[model samples]
Target chain A: MEHLDALENQSIYILREAYKKFKKLAMLWSIGKDSTVLLWLARKAFFGHCPIPLVHIDTSYKIPAMIAFRDQLAREWSLRLIVGQNTAALADGMGPERGRLTCCTALKTEGLQLLMAERGFTGLILGIRRDEEGTRAKERYFSPRDKHFEWNYKDQPPELWDQFKTDFDADTHIRIHPLLHWTEIDVWEYIRREAIPIIDLYFAKDGERYRSLGCWPCTGRVKSNAATVEEIIAELRATNTSERAGRAQDHEDTYAMQKLRAKGYM
Target chain B: MATDIATPRASSNIVIVGHVDHGKSTLVGRLFYDTDSLPEGRYAAVARVCEETGKPFEFAFLLDALEEERDQGITIDTARARFHTARRDYVLIDAPGHKEFLKNMVSGAAAADAALLLIDAAEGVQEQSRRHGYLLHLLGIRQVVVVINKMDLVGYRQRAFADVRRAYLDFLAALGVHPQAVVPVSAREGDNIAAASARMPWYDGPTVVEALDAFAARPSREHLPLRFPVQDVYKFDHRRIIAGRVEAGAIAEGDTILFTPSGHRGVVKSIERWHPSRTGPARAGESIGITLTEQLFIERGEVISHLADAPRAGAELRANLFWLGDRHLAPGRPYVLKLATQEVPCAAAGVSGVINTATLEHVAAHEVAKNEVATVTLALKTPVAYDCFTDIVETGRFVLVDGYDVAGGGIVLPPVEDDYTI
Candidate 1:
């Protein structure tokens, strides 16, 4: 319980800082467990109201249930939703078949880039956790993205104490990761503790469940009998597979995530 | 969904610091491997990568995730990994010790509650060995365990272990850092990490894991006086909510609060929360919103506390700063000083007592360069509320923003006429 409190407080602090710092800020909502928790934290920080707008990049390949869940929650919570899609790329037939990395860059990263450009959001809040991937382990809480939406991972600014790089070039957008310090278990545990509603895809059905949700074609389900959140927590505790093991884009190459992230793929 | 996880384990963040090629990452990898903390197939995955590249397998590769870092054979940034023991969970932060990556090291060290300072037994005490120790003290990491690594290189001799341990301990004592324990081990060979080593019968103190397990988590600041730096004021509807995190102490309805620097006092009308049923006093480490009886002209950077124990307000502050900017920190150059939520344009009034961390020598200089430590007096454009770092850390620590980047971080010191060591 104490551990949860610390994580929750730190996240809430980051959320409030983003709100206080950026005038034109938005949060990326993937309708995944991590983003759902981030949405919950935003409400907690603003006293039951999410002040920042929520941006959802529609790859058009997300599970139907995920889209349904997103709309339902947005309406229920009175959240301002901004959906972005790369129609040009989609019309040109950009997909996993073209190549997972290329597809992610086009549909996901480029989609987000277009939305950010159109909406003119100076700061974006994401729910990326360090424990999820090796490349993510080197991320700072307040990461900066260039005007071209490129993550300059090679020469990242130093962040110490609770002080972050809030000051940035007007053309650059900052990526605020409130849950960067959290692990996979911490996310599931917080979802359980807060009783936050989640999509049904994560729960096991017929001895299989999607451990990580992404584009449907690229995401695979793991064999598990864990049906409830409690059982999922137990399963995570006993499992050794990485959280993104089921996501095919990461396995496309050794440094695939690093490459994709550097190009601004969340 | 349920309420919480089963058996909520305590998590401690421990940063590993040492000179370059001192086996910081190797020790972390070995610790994870010996404790069964690595995910299944992670070892095999690294082994496969090495095989594919036709290179020998190294424990450090498990953490040096970047291809460039692997190719360069050095960690460019701090990498964190999760491991667990029976007592608690650990986030081992592998911080680079190269001087070029000092900012990266400071970033890693600042978040850690405890630290493990590694020293190569074969190399004895090097420059970074002392420099990292000084930095640990400056960062206020009180709980440290010194690990003398590469015992196998010296044939596990007690003399070599004693030599490095003695030199490093003497240097730390001057900085007022009393490490928890100094354990001798070989991270590459996995000696005295998780298990006791038969190679060193002369050492019976504790293994690296045991030393880490002995560390106690710092207590929360709930008992201290209230210090809430107002982050912002939001009026989503008709009600104006003052939102901020309670850095210390707790606040409830009907509590009298004083906003420092402005000297405005108000009564707490109500403590606002998201969940109605979870209503109570907002304690330290909680982000909360509240309504005041009077609508004062309160803005961000106002430190709210009980009127009796409010923080000191001044425009001129004495601080010990560590410069990490590409440009030198000299007088007459304006920089943005961010303390708590306060951001004010400030200038270095004077630079004195500049210490080269590598050599631990005081050089008479008018400016500080990158990766150098110095005691500086800053002149702020406006008065801000703060306490000495010894009194309250959240209010005292600050960072200097040059142009659009955070250039330096430092802790506030008490104003004294004579120079003194902390």
Candidate 2:
């Protein structure tokens, strides 16, 4: 777990930096393994207590178990959990049938945008890793989003050494990514080492398991018998299957994630 | 079961830098292809795109993922790829070599443990070849393998390779850098890449992959003096924990630590890790918390180190830096200087000279423009603990923020003193 140790240190450093730099900050927790591990790191960073609020954009299509797990941990850890949803869009019949990208933009990106506007939060901590997707690789640790929450990835600020772009204009918000350097295997390895509690949806139930969690309607499962964390790690090491192979949204188009992210989808 | 006990493979961050269109991306893509590191269907997917578009298969296509970059056929940002050799794993950072993308290059080079300075043998040494070499020196990347690429364009001639190598070596020598080796490669032809080139029988050296595998990893600085820059102080229900990463050396329970700038001292009562399984001494690169015996008036942006070998605290110091902002860096204008966790209002008291990165010539200047390196004397509003860039990279470097942007970055000059009169 030496590699995990290094990754943990770097992540904790970034988390602390975010906490110290931004006054009104919140962490996005998808109730998935990566965000759960990020939550654990926040607790470790703030000495067993995370003062930052955890924001969850509930799409109303999430698997039932994800909500259950989220609430259980929030209650157990006494976390300041904040759930945001695009109620108007959901009521207007916004779903995957109306096009995956449109549905995601309304439910996820617009939902988070409304949440930010209402709460006036300047910084958002996310559990995104570069190895997960092509667009994610181009992201800086502290990425800026304009007033409309549009990501200008083309003309990004210069980020050299450990000097991140923490300072932003009044209307600009920064997305803090602590797990950008870690890989899928690194996450699983750290989860095992720290004994972090994760939702069982990742474990194989009936010859299949969710490699990447999302809305129940769109998320698919990969064939695997990796029932334990250690088994999952071994499978990840040997398998060439993409981590998001089971996430249907990513496979919707070649640049689906990029298009979603450009509009500020976490 | 034995795999559980086996140590993790040592990993190094390697950056590839060269002039624009020098095949930096192609070289990186070739490495991934030669090592079979591309994920399932990734290569095939890109190849399929090429076929559908009626374009020839390009290794660079694998990395230029962005729409604009693909259309322009230029890398605008640093692309990272993980490649594993029999000896170790590498995080290969492919830096854009365009002059305007110098910031991206710096961002990539800053995290590198070693570097591959690529130069086209046909073009000989270009402006970026020298600029990148100068940057690698500034970033403290001592281990470098100069890659003279495009041997095919130069007919794989030993004389062409030697000419570029000799010129680049001279350039590096002027910057006080001694690279580990100079390698010949043709990323397009796959010569001296994964395997030695039969075309260049006269040249005998390690291939690009072999050179990378042979590059030495940075030694752990655990024996050095402890430098724990306080990131924050947390009070979780009366159990106050001072949180920070151990940048250098180690810290143990009962160790007397001193906070710089504030000049507060206390004893470490205990080391706290979130996982109950972790206990005992904390070594370098560990981000842990510690409960102090006494609640001293300590805050973030202070360096906590052993009292015996404490870091120098000063208000005025000399530094070497490179400016990347659109506006020129001039004296008398106060900017935020952030070093480690500390941020203070600072201004350039004096600009001794600005060195043209390409030519390595010192020129008298009142302001440092974009892509220019300079030595300046900074006047800080508050004293901060720091070391020379050569002594300790963690505490030695800083960024100058102007109006909510990082305008410039630099390293502290050695022999910290209070008497920095302009």
Candidate 3:
């Protein structure tokens, strides 16, 4: 719990810094455990109120329960939720049947990019932990993207100590990650300690559970008997499987995630 | 490892630094392997790639995640790995040792509670061995363990280990760093890593893991004077709350606090939190909000300190810094100096000297070149609250930003009236 406390303090500090630095800032809520915890931290950072809006990219392939859970929490917590979609691409018959990468780019990455451009959002708060994936490990707390939303991982700015690069050039959008230092276990532990609400899909039912949540067509379930949060934590401690094992896009190729991230995929 | 029964152990961040190809990543990977820290299927997946590529399984491969780094067989950035011992858990930060990646090294070193300065026994002390030691001292990491790796190359001889240890010790002594221990190991052969090596009969000391577990945790800054740098002020509905992480000491309701650079003072009306479970004083490391009794015009980049022992405010500062920018840090050129939460436009008013990290010798310089360490006096546009780096690290350390990128980092020297010699 002490470790969780430290992680919480650090995350809250980052959240406060993001809020103070950017004028046009919004948080991306995936309706997953990570983003839900991020939403909770935002509330904690602002003291029972979240002034920034929450942006969710709806691919229309999400499980029905996820949208219901998102709306219920938004209403209960008084959240200003903004739902976006690439309706044009969706109507153009874009789905997993058409290459997963292309489908994700059009419906998810392009959707978010279009929404950001239309809303003139300069910064976005994301809930990405380094231990979740290899590419995420290379990210800075305040990562910058070009006007075209491309990530140049090779030449990232040097971030030393608590002094992050908050100033960016014109037409540059920054991705703010408060959970970069946390591990997957740290996330679950913090959730338990804070008693933050999460979707029930995480808990096992019919001898299977969702370790990571994404679009319904691409995300798969892992076999587990973790019926409670406590059981899930125990399973996580005992298992050597990667947290993103069920995320199909990551396993498409060795560099699938990296390529997607370079193209501004969240 | 049940969630309800497990008690969280104390965790420390340890950085691994040395010259490029000094086996920093291999040693880190071996640590994880010996400690069983690698997650399920990770090692298997890496091994599968090795088999498919017709290459031998390398411990360093565990860390080199990027395609370029893997193909080039070098660590390009700081990669973090988690390991646990009976005593504590450690976040091992494997920093690239190449001179070009010095910025990445600093990024990793700045957050470390302890450090492992690696040196090849066969090669003895090298340029980066000294450079990294100097950086560790500058970054305020007092708990260091000099790791003499690749003993297999030296035939596991005690003489080679002793010579390297002596050389590295002399270098560390020049920079005022006293290492906790000097360990000898072969990261490739797995000797003296997790278990003591029978190969080195003449050398009897704790293994690398034991040395790590022996490192003392950094003492808490609770008893120190309160210094909370205001991050932002939020108005939730009608109640105005000043938010920031308490860098040192503690703050409670009714405590009178003073904001620096602005010279405003107010009493803490109440400690605020979204969850009502926390109702007491907020200590160091806790990010919380407090409502002030008097409505003061306090903004971001202001330090909130206890009125009794307020931090000193000064416009002129003397500092020792390590430059990382491609452009030379010259006098009269303005740069943004960010310390704690404050960022002020500052210029190099005077340059005393620059130290050649390779030789540990002082050289006269009008400007600090890239990857050089120097002592200089800065003139700030406005006064800001600060303390000596030795006294309070949070208020003393700073980074210089050039053209929106972090160019250099330094610590404030103790205030001197006339003398400006390092």
Most lDDT-accurate candidate: 1
In angstroms, how far off is A190's CA in candidate 2? Answer: 1.2
* Structure candidate 2, residue pairs in collision: none
- With candidate 2 superimposed using the best TM-score fit, by how many Å does residue A218's alpha carbon deviate from the native? 1.7
Note the residue pairs that clash in candidate 1.
Answer: A193-B3
Docking class of 3: medium
True contacts kept of each: 0.71, 0.58, 0.69
Q: Where does model 1 exceed 4 Å of error?
A: B1-5, B276-278
Local error of candidate 3 at A241, Å?
Answer: 1.0
> What TM-score does chain B of candidate 3 reach?
0.97
- Model 2 bad stretches (over 4 Å): B1-7, B415-422
Candidate 3, B50-147: lDDT as tens digits: 78667899888787778778777888888787888767789999899998889988888888999999999988888888888888888888999989
Q: Taking the tens digit of each residue's C-alpha lDDT, what string does model 2 give over B43-110?
A: 88678767866778989878777767776889998878788877788999988999898888888788
For model 2, the local distance difference test gives 0.88
* lDDT score of residue A20 within candidate 3: 86
Candidate 3 chain B: worst 10 consecutive residues by lDDT? B1-10
CAPRI-style grade of the A/B interface in model 1: medium
Displacement of residue B303 (Cα, Å) in model 1 is 0.1
